[model samples]
Target chain A: AQSVAQPEDQVNVAEGNPLTVKCTYSVSGNPYLFWYVQYPNRGLQFLLKYITGDNLVKGSYGFEAEFNKSQTSFHLKKPSALVSDSALYFCAVRDSVSGTYKYIFGTGTRLKVLA
Target chain B: EAEVAQSPRYKITEKSQAVAFWCDPISGHATLYWYRQILGQGPELLVQFQDESVVDDSQLPKDRFSAERLKGVDSTLKIQPAELGDSAMYLCASSLGLERINEQFFGPGTRLTVL
Candidate 1:
């Protein structure tokens, strides 16, 4: 079974401080990790994806994620938090080895950047 | 920027009523996906289409939910005799190719409320 875990229900960070949203996964084959962001009532926006090569991947809105294979983790990060960056973040994983295109997503983590 | 499009950004319906949502993928994107997202959770794939053909519908509730991409340019999802549990945000996304390695572009979702 392919599954993703976002342990934190909410993450609060002070403005201008770095932020991290944790994510971990379990899958049968190699994992393709992705991150997305959603604002109130809107659909998700793609952040970044880790298919191969670099362990650290950068994406939209000054966000990036690091794919750690041994740890089975892909954590979203930001160099500096902004109030506008506050939103719901989700982590998803696709198992290439399983030959399935469907992605399994974790329960979201709400990011609140204090102004 | 080209983006996926969806209709009826908000809908409120009574239980047992029928409802439908429409989506148009980004131009030149061959793969389309429909997802159901419950609040506080991640979006789950309901169906996937490659052009005019259905690639996957395993997660869709066949008893009531049905989806089609008649010409492969746009698609529609219909649900008959809706239940309270069916209330959720229906998101539509599209990607560039068949390999499923490309990042997906999402639309503003349709928010459904079943009474």
Candidate 2:
């Protein structure tokens, strides 16, 4: 079975400071990882994904994530946090070996950017 | 900027009542998914469809919840005898295909409140 874990329930960072949201996963084979952000009363928007590429992947809204195979982690990051970036972040994973399209998602991490 | 569309942005119903949500995926999308998101949690897959055929529904509560994407382009999910636990945001997503790296596009989700 494949699973994802978001260790933090919430993260607080000052605006203009670097921000990081942690995520880790367990899968039977190579993993396809994704990050999504959901704002209040809105649908989740895709941030970025890591299938088979460079360790660091950049995404929408200046967000990026680094896929660390040794750590089994794909942590979301932003060079400079913005108030607008405050939202719920989710990490999802799909096992390529399973040949199934289902994605397992973590509980989520709430990010708050303080002014 | 084609995106998934969902109906009944908000719904309120008494316990034991039946409620349904609808989704219209982007044109040409071959895969659609239904997910349930409880407060403060990431969305969980309830069902997945590939070209009007159910590809995965293991997480769906078949006893009380049902989903159908008869025409393949649009889908519906129904819950009978709604329980308080069913009150949450129901999200719909669609993707191009079952490719391991395909990105899913999400809809604005329908918030259901069981009273």
Candidate 3:
């Protein structure tokens, strides 16, 4: 089974401060991790993904994520938080060895950038 | 850029009523997925289609939920006798293929409210 977890239900950060949303995963084989953001009444937007390259992957809206194989974690990060960045964040994983194409997602974390 | 499209941005219905949602994937995309997102949770996959063929539906509730992609272009998901727990957002996504590396494009979800 492949699963992801976002321990925090919500994260609050001051504007211009660095922010992080934690995510951890479990998979039977190598994992393909991804991050997505969703705004109010809108569909989820792709942020970034880690397949098999560098540990740090850059994404849209000045966001990035670090994939730690030893820790089984892929945490989304931003150098400077913006009010517009406040939204719901989700982490997803696909087990490449599982021979399935489906992705398992975490419960999601709500990010609030305070001005 | 081309994107996935969904219909009925919002729906309200009494318990035991039937409701349906539709999705149109981006041109040439061969994989489509339907997901249900409860409040404060990540989207959960309900069904997946690959070129009009059912690829996965392990998590879908067969008793009340049915999905079909007749022409490999558009798809429909119907829930009969919807329960209160069915109130949530129905999301549709598409990918170029079943490869794990392909990113899925999402459509604006349909918010269903079961009264």
Q: lDDT rank, highest first?
A: 3, 2, 1
- Measured over all alpha carbons after superposition, the RMSD of each candidate to the real structure, in angstroms, is 1.2, 1.0, 1.0
What lDDT tens digits, residue by residue, belong to model 3 across residues A35-98? 9999999899999999888999999999999999999999999999999999999999865664
Model 3 chain A poorest 10 in a row by lDDT: A94-103
Tell me the tens digit of each residue's lDDT in model 1 across B1-99. 998999989999999999999999999999999999998888989998999888788999999999999998999999998999999999999988668
- The pairs that clash in candidate 3 are none
- Candidate 3 structure quality by residue, lDDT tens digits, B1-115: 8989999999999999999999999999999999999988899999999999998899999999999999999999999989999999999999898874877899999999999
TM-score of every model? 0.96, 0.97, 0.97
Candidate 3 docks with a DockQ of 0.85
Which of 2 and 3 is ahead in lDDT? 3
Whole-model Cα lDDT per candidate? 0.92, 0.92, 0.93
Off by over 4 Å in 1: none
- Compared with the true structure, what per-residue lDDT tens digits does model 2 show for residues B3-115? 89999999999999999999999999998999999988889899999998998898999999999988788999999989999999999999888974777899999999999
- The global Cα lDDT (0 to 1) of model 3 is 0.93
